[model samples]
Target: MSNRSYSSQPKSVVIVGAGIIGATLGYHISRRAGMTVTLLERDLPGAGASGHSFAWVNGFGKDPRAYHTLNRRSLDMWYRLAHQLDADIGIHYGGEMRWENDPRRATQLRQRVRQIQTWGYPCRLITRAEMLALEPHLHPGDVLAASLSEADIHVETDTFIDVCLRRACEAGAVVYSQTAVTGFVVRDGSIAAVKTVDAEFPCDVVVLASGVQTTELASLAQVQIPQQQSPGIVMKTTPCVEVLHNVAVIHAPAIDEKHQHLHLRQLSDGSLRIGQGTQEGINRDDSQQQADALLDRARAYLPTIGDARAIPTPVGYRPMPLDGFPVLGFTEAVPNLYVALMHSGVTLAPLVGEMATLEIVDDVRVDWFASYRPERFSVRSSG
Candidate 1:
């Protein structure tokens, strides 16, 4: 959208990784008249980050203003899609609860609620008594209190992804599974096509929603992607007679190493997702040492969680982004190339799809030209 303007005409687009972002983008693109779409993934859709997400759809943990707005937009789409595709997706308005014990933090929490409200997010500050009355099983800590944000809703991630893929197919998009894109055929100022191991898929545009593996994927495409990895570890416990009914969390993740926070949510089938530990590191799979460390951390909150699971799962996702927010829009350098990625993929996937749809399908021009342009890294190389 710089010197080159876009016309509101449909075009052929190729998307990489059929996760939430990719699938949604593919679906939306295919829906537009005169548009053709192709989706490529190394595995079946939703088998990667989208499948293993915490799925705790909340705006509290997100950055206020832009991020919170983005989350809410995605959330609205998530709910709408659930009902629109109810047979294939189940959406639950599981209230998200966050509390703080520190006096200073309690005040700050209330201020945050006000900030969120001012920004149009529905939120309310509740007293300890009110909170306990709503969720009685919570440990009555001797300090501040909790804030109930009804905006948070838990959804079946895999199911929604599958339904989205089906929608994409119904809309006439071709999806290629187990296809690893190795290169981008760049001709003139635009991406002409992408090279996969088995064949070449040509398109007028390519939307890059490669998720955590964006760095490597960008490398193959000869594009410099500004990103980093924020590793997360999550575990699930065998169902109890109901240790907790609603999802509860301590509200702050960066308190201290000794402060292990638990975000517990009950799945549809009565299984409970117990999560607390997140750190920075790389591990393709789980290990004995990681399990032991996770257990010790889980014990710090509810000792029974890790003890019940025995071998807790080691969850991992590198919430990749350029700065603190998502990297989006078409690259200034590569005319037909676009990038979209961030931490709350489940919560923000719909919005990402919408924005990308605006750019690729509707031909709406958005200039990240310098600020959010995906090829900013390439500009540095030229410098």
Candidate 2:
């Protein structure tokens, strides 16, 4: 959209959604010379999917070598981004620890560790003693196989998002909270301006990073980006003594046949966020009973988690593409309209922010996003 032939370098860029992706992208674009950046959000930052995410930053579960590599690259880039920000970005750097109680799962875990290792992932199988050494308080019962992915970490999404938005604002970007996107002003085939509830932002380019609502917003421009329903819940707990001392995240084995594995991480405030099944697991129950059950399960391994009560959080709907990969880049029907929607927003924020800035401000198409182009979804006829 900022091509040399198409008017001088997209002087104005309007970004919809102030979530992690939008905040990161806004921060990056605002720093670019001669670009006026504006971020529009219907609610406060991190109030959407980013707020309720497990916030684990890892590539261990990403399948296919290319996808795994994408996550791995971003996971490493976080360190550099934090250094560049030069502020406390709520990044916990203890890596991830997990163990298997069943022989079948142990074999699967062993195979998975080897598979990722071949791709240069910093992960390996560990002995029971090594597991205990990494986490002394963990009472992992009957560990058949254990692992320590030394590169994995989790984030406090709220803290990181707040910091990013503050930095973006400091760099001359205007963030409009409580401003909902009404529609788009299209000229020829490109978005000329983004319309909000009470105002309209004239821009050369518009980006939709509105999480689960991306599909609906993009449709106003006649761009069809389909997404699957991916509602998940991550229950929070009252602040208590720090349970995770060495690791930022821990995946505990399921206690019985009906239950799934549990993953949890402690926030900087000493509150613990626990989730069941998998990162992509579907859970709609935000009832107090469900929260209590999850907290009780967490207590099974970390018995020292004394008096930390569970707090029910609403289910978060992930912006999952039908194929389960990110959908990035501009659309065929709307060249100046960029869509940044994905499930692993926290894991991919750094990479997407930097590379998308290149694609947007510098007008260069990135090869890394070739597989995730928006044209992959058939665009509906504008007529």
User: Best candidate per TM-score, number?
Assistant: 2
For all predicted structures, in order, the TM-scores are 0.84, 0.97
For every model in order, what is the number of clashing pairs? 0, 0
**Backbone clash pairs in model 2 (N, Cα, C under 3 Å; residues 3+ apart or in different chains), count:** 0
lDDT of 1 by residue, 1-383 (tens): 34333344647788988888898788777877888889999888887777766777767656746666667777777766666554657466746777776777778888988988888787788787876676565554554756888768876677777787788788888889898888888777667789987688887788888888776776665667867766665555555444445543333232454655555665666455545543223444456565555445444444334344534666667657657567787766666677877677878777677677877776666543224556555655554
Give me the displacement of residue 35 in model 1, in angstroms.
Answer: 2.2
- lDDT, residue 135, candidate 2: 79
For model 1, what is the error of residue 171's alpha carbon versus the real structure, in angstroms, after optimal superposition?
Answer: 1.7
**Model 1, which residues run further than 4 Å from truth?**
1-10, 86-88, 239-257, 277-311, 366-371, 375-378, 381-383
lDDT of 1 at 69: 64
lDDT of candidate 2 over 215-258, digit per residue (tens): 99988988889999999999999999989889899999999889
The pairs that clash in candidate 1 are none
Give the total clashing residue pairs for model 1: 0
